[model samples]
Target: MASLSHLNQQLLSTNTLPFTPLNSTPSISPPTIGFRSKSFGRPIVASADVSRRVVYVHAVTSDDEWGPDRDVPYAGVAVAVEEKPVETETDKLKKALVDSFYGTDRGLKASSETRAEIVELISQLEAKNPTPAPTDALTLLNGKWILVYTSFAGLFPLLSSGTLPLVKVEEISQTIDSEAFTVQNSVRFAGPLTTTSISTNAKFEVRSPKRVQIKFDEGIIGTPQLTDSLEIPENVEFLGQRIDLTPFKGILTSVQNTASSVVRTISNQPPLKFPISNNKAQSWLLTTYLDEELRISRGDGGGVFVLIKEGSSLLTNQRN
Candidate 1:
């Protein structure tokens, strides 16, 4: 049994080839039980080594009724056996990824109007606007206790329920005081989350608005974690739309262009933002440096940038 298993493994490891069996012609006389040939041509390259039986033939000839020697064919039949191929890590990973996203309940998209409507609805619920304020962090939430966590528990359900539009989010941790804002770790969201989403666990730090260095504590919350001394901007846009700039630290990632070149930085950062008030509209502002125009597509699919850039301003139709 072990020998057969090893043989099967060897056959499976090799590349595949076609198998054709040749039957005996009607005109050829069958050899007697005692009759045997002295020589066999290359052992007829049988497809299998099973059942080493004895046989006799009057003559062996190349079945060539055609032109060139290269086109000549050898005619004979014996047995055939096949083995299964072994899988590698890369193949497994590929299969896993394909099964995870393709043709599954884990993926979907909204129309432009649908996306805009949903964003507006979320804004209304959060009482915010879709417009982005300047990139200042201090003036907005100077004395708010921004609570941040490192989990995506509630957000994924809100998205899959069709009550929300997926905005490509990029989260960075910074300590904002009455000074300035600094970027810590940045993760660009690629796809919508499956119920079995991956955990974005990493240590990072954000520059406080006042430029004061603040450290994020995993066990502590709501005790004046990081103080921002700078003046917070009235509005802040995130992922090209409006969102609530709260003082909570949690997982920060967007479901936009998964290939955006935002890398992870800052070893001690938290996922939190503290706007002055939750009453005002908050949005996500995506910064770019493309010399040419940066176009954004409607809510078609991933990486669909429908926003057009005219000079220094960006233009997008409210609908369709």
Candidate 2:
């Protein structure tokens, strides 16, 4: 904790990124609230019960004109048949951001240097946002989005400390059912016994070309799901050093063996629910960037969120 604080303080002294809204323009206002994290406790009836509402998944093609640079041969045009590798500055920056996230633990473990780089890249990407008015293109917002990067400090502690000392955040995602005019944000946490989640479901009102007012109506404490297996990483690097997990394999295996009955009992129960405190839970989201796969939005106070559509190549791409 001390080291993490020191790193942040040092980074602050050297850089102003993340603190200032990246590429803020006068038309947009900084968000008063940050994205919900551990604070959103309890559950109520969801406005758009997605459990019953089907979110149809379909394959998406490139929105760009390049269409993946493939080669087609006409005997006379051999030269034109060669496949071309055309990468834009945006492409490079996107890959760079992903690489920066390599060991950051979703910004929790990010070093001062890595944080600065991430903020810079986010600003650059915002400057080139293809669709500045995201609300204008509602069709692209119709599916699950996996949050890849965020400077919303609220989630950092959750990502760092977690719900319990040993619990870790598995995924933080947002599902938008455009047809139903609803949005659901959920964060999943994993523990030794079972994996569970906390979520908020809200109805969104389009206020402007790029802005949306989200009124959170419900929160849910998801039912615990038993883990299929005890999957441990081969090793982890701590304090610039790699530590092997082989020594702890026996201990983990022992825990996995005892997971049967208790885990099953918990999984059979229903998830809990509660009504949202309308005044505190509502917030404005300004879409600075939007496309078929990637989305970048800022809250009323400037907390930045970068998300990738579930089936996006952005998630499947190779990273350094």
Candidate 3:
């Protein structure tokens, strides 16, 4: 009687062994030799003749490699060979939070389950790794972030009925020695009867690593001019008020200045005059949930904001 290991090697070397595709039914040929063992019940061997006597064998191959070779059982063999990565609880929680905001439009409210999951994940993540020092805050918050979800009630009114508007936000970034921070926002409203874009710039202060105060010193709010392919309606209302773009034509226009005082205010050092306003500055507490990807923040008035990093394609696709 031939050893099972030797028989397996012979079967593999000779390409004549039957192999069924994965998840396919195995065709059974008449067995020419029946090898019976005390350990492994019955082994089927296919050959040209079926009138052979049964051979009892005492030796068996290693248990881990192959099973009693009948007609190559494809279903169980394929699954055991391929390995899958083990997902951790933290990973699952983070993925759930990302899925809640990914591809979601501005001003959309998250579901209750999503909100709970995000809160739990943020709590767990922060507990494991404390917030970085105040000096390290600017490095993480310097890039452009696209609005994903906001708990602020005011933003919901910006969306008319069932239309998704485009909201792009440039953050207020500052170094430790930097005294001022600037934020630029552009929101495009496309309705059935009107299409308009409102852009604004605000100067702010970073009090600490977790806190920022934004002052709306200067801004330009109006409807942008449309191209030949697009036209604005006769009447347009944004944020529950009628919009007049004529007065905002030169409101926030940038001008070159050689003055040293102007250079101190802007981070990019572009010489421009920014007039201070009497309006009070609002404070916001930032909580970064994912590095360079997602952030959750709350205003002094208890409104929450979720921001996601935007790619260059998002800016290019915006309507002028």
Candidate 4:
């Protein structure tokens, strides 16, 4: 006897399900072998380690050993596995796209490298789009969506110093009413104490599964609203340039009461709406990707636009 060791096992008939394997791969040692008595001239019997996929069985490999002549003892162990919440591929890609827009100033300050990376991410997300024929999915598209990122060069002027430093681009949003089949695109500008917006009201027709033809009917130059209290900041920054507006702060603060009444009266009037007679007021868009909170579309001009649903975490995170 080569120093008989303890071996624990249960004799099982080969008929039942052996064991449900653990959910992980395990490292097992070599089998134990026992030599029969030489005088008796009996062959040696060896017990091999058994393993199953994802599950580990307590075969006889513990520090406590048993005699070789005994049958193998088997016991199933209950492993407490910590399960992690899973994120789908679409969720991962959506996060990547949102993170890419952190400091790019809505793609206005994005460099070529950053732009290429964004395009790549957009393409990947488009490939994994869960919603098909996004135009027909009117219920999903019925709310206002804020523009988060875009490659269109046409909107550059609004985002750049062309708007002058005294005013800043407050928001660019698209509001869609599926029931009325109408769309309104608005760009808001915020000044020292007043906020103004320019919007286009358009009617859309679904021309295809993924395309919609939109003809803008009217354009509105919204009367400036007296929203912000007259408070002059020490300085203001726009497109990386900061200016000292503190000089006018005191003078404006003195006359704020007078200015507030005038702005309020002017804002009380209805917005100015004009018929859009220009041929350029019509365009088509192809929705490439859409989910509950994020959307990506391509315009006829070959520019990509990425919009986030209003009140989503992407906007909240950006604001924070």
Candidate 5:
């Protein structure tokens, strides 16, 4: 018998019915009970505010079923990686020159492109590292240098064509003393039946750090016929004696940068020329390139000599 309006208000205040506008339909939901403490058989209900509070929770999956489609938020700032510096022109040139010398093929030919490249590199290097004259220059030349390239007109044809019958050069040493210098060259040549060894000695003077004068003094030629199994020929007796062969004299003039030079010398006397002739000295520019272990000198007439240090290998060791 309670009023209908009063009953409706009671239902709405208790949350049993949802409030709506006058023209809208009323919404109904299941009844919610507040959590209460239990003592023996009786129940003590909690406050109405506690029952009205709503909570939401999100669950995270432990499996990888949603891994590909999951949206992951980055927790760190982005960073960039750095790169190495580029090589300089000088470094590239140096590498190219070294490759030309110690590369697969042993020697650089006079007319080849590699030789031209070497010449260009030498010029650039000399310009960058200009060496002073006299003291500094002579000190630099003190060490033993293996000849890696040479172009002396006299010896090139014989070495290239293998017509001189020379088997190998045992040793070629240039020793500079305080007052004088000596050049000793030992060579082994193949004879008709056996091999003969010959040693040539030359004395020189360092006129200045940039200039040198060389004079051929004596030659110790071995007797190949004596060692041969065949009967000795009467005409071969000259090989036994230490012949006072004709002396070869020449002057080498180096440039200020210590990179190239010019040589004025009489043509070397032929091996058979006894009582050597005093031929007029000829002048030619010699383009010289040197590092710690190798020495390359090219003559204007297209002769090349490749010499290496006494104990060094052609490939692994090079001048710094």
Candidate 6:
């Protein structure tokens, strides 16, 4: 009998082979041959016939640089040669696609449009929305005045030392020194209240809808020695009413004496506990009137808008 390996070579040339099983391992059937040519990307081979003890096998290997060298009758081997079938372009394409993204991570998979939609929805939820102002101050601002906003200069050394004082009403201009602050209605008032307020440390805590507590450094009130939160009510107006000074929108009208600067801003980010999502964008409405100066700043944390108005108010109107 010809060598099984030699027979395989002949089968390659003749393109004719028969299905059969191996002699030794009848249970171990003959090896099936898979034909893969440079031209045929995908080739399907037939299963061996275990009963015959003879079969044909095909394989391409660069290291070997050839098919099975020569099939030999070693260990009860039965070999038969057969023809390999050709694959169509469509079959090749389908197989290629399946291998690319099917079972494996790289295999062909389903569309992600649903995921895209979800991502888009999330983007809308996290989107930066411009707060709508009740009024724009374009017409109300023009000329040099005392600019007073939240201070970037931190606390005036002595301001936090002790009780501050409410001073005689001073001219509102761009030059209120650090020691000139007045408190009224629980909100501290800083000087140089122009389109901007700079350099006087102003801090406030919103304890409740009916109560807000604000504190100014002692030195910022012109009379740093006697200023106290208790006496703040005696100097400024609107002492009894609950006040809200958040800005929902508006641009900067002018600066008192500072260099050309961007307006500040305030955000109305609801607590995460409130549970707001893209589906409820409109429900989480932040409404306010913008008739004041705003200060805009950029730093490590992020940008913030500080509403700087001698006297302005913000309201959250319920959404329809």
**Which candidate achieves the best lDDT against the true structure?**
4
TM-score of each candidate structure, all chains considered together: 0.16, 0.63, 0.46, 0.68, 0.40, 0.16
Worst 10 residues of 5 by lDDT: 257-266
- Residue-level lDDT of model 2, residues 105-153, one tens digit each, is 6676677898898888888988988887778778888899998877789
* Candidate 3 lDDT by residue in tens digits, 1-320: 55545565554444333332222233564343333324344333322223222222222332323354444332211111223457766555545555555433443455666666656765675554334543255655666676656656766666433344443332221212233467666565554323444555666676776666666555454443222222324456889999775554443232222222333443233223345566564445555443554456667776666655666332333221
- Give candidate 6 misplaced runs (Cα > 4 Å): 1-153, 156-158, 161-305, 314-320
The weakest ten consecutive residues by lDDT in model 1 span 142-151
The clash number for model 4 is 15
Candidates' lDDT values, in order? Answer: 0.27, 0.69, 0.47, 0.73, 0.40, 0.28
Worst 10 residues of 2 by lDDT: 39-48
lDDT tens digits, residue span 137-191, model 1: 3344222121111112333453344334543322212222334332222223322
Per-residue C-alpha lDDT of model 5 across residues 156-220, encoded as one tens digit per residue = 44344334453433233443342345655555556443445565556656554334555556666
Off by over 4 Å in 4: 1-85, 161-163, 232-253
Cα error, residue 250 of model 3, in Å, equals 38
Sorted on TM-score, highest at the top, how do the candidates line up?
4, 2, 3, 5, 1, 6
What is the per-residue lDDT of model 4 for residues 1-320, given as tens digits with 9 covering 90 to 100?
33222121221222132332222232444322222221122222222233211222233322322333334344543222334558888888888888888778788889999898999999899888888889879888889999988889988877895258678888999999999999999999887777889999999999998899999999999987875356566888988999888778767786887887787689779999999998888999899888889989999988899998998987787630
- The local lDDT score (0 to 100) that residue 80 gets in candidate 2 is 18
TM-score of 6: 0.16
**lDDT at residue 113 of model 1 (Cα atoms):** 53
Best by TM-score: 4
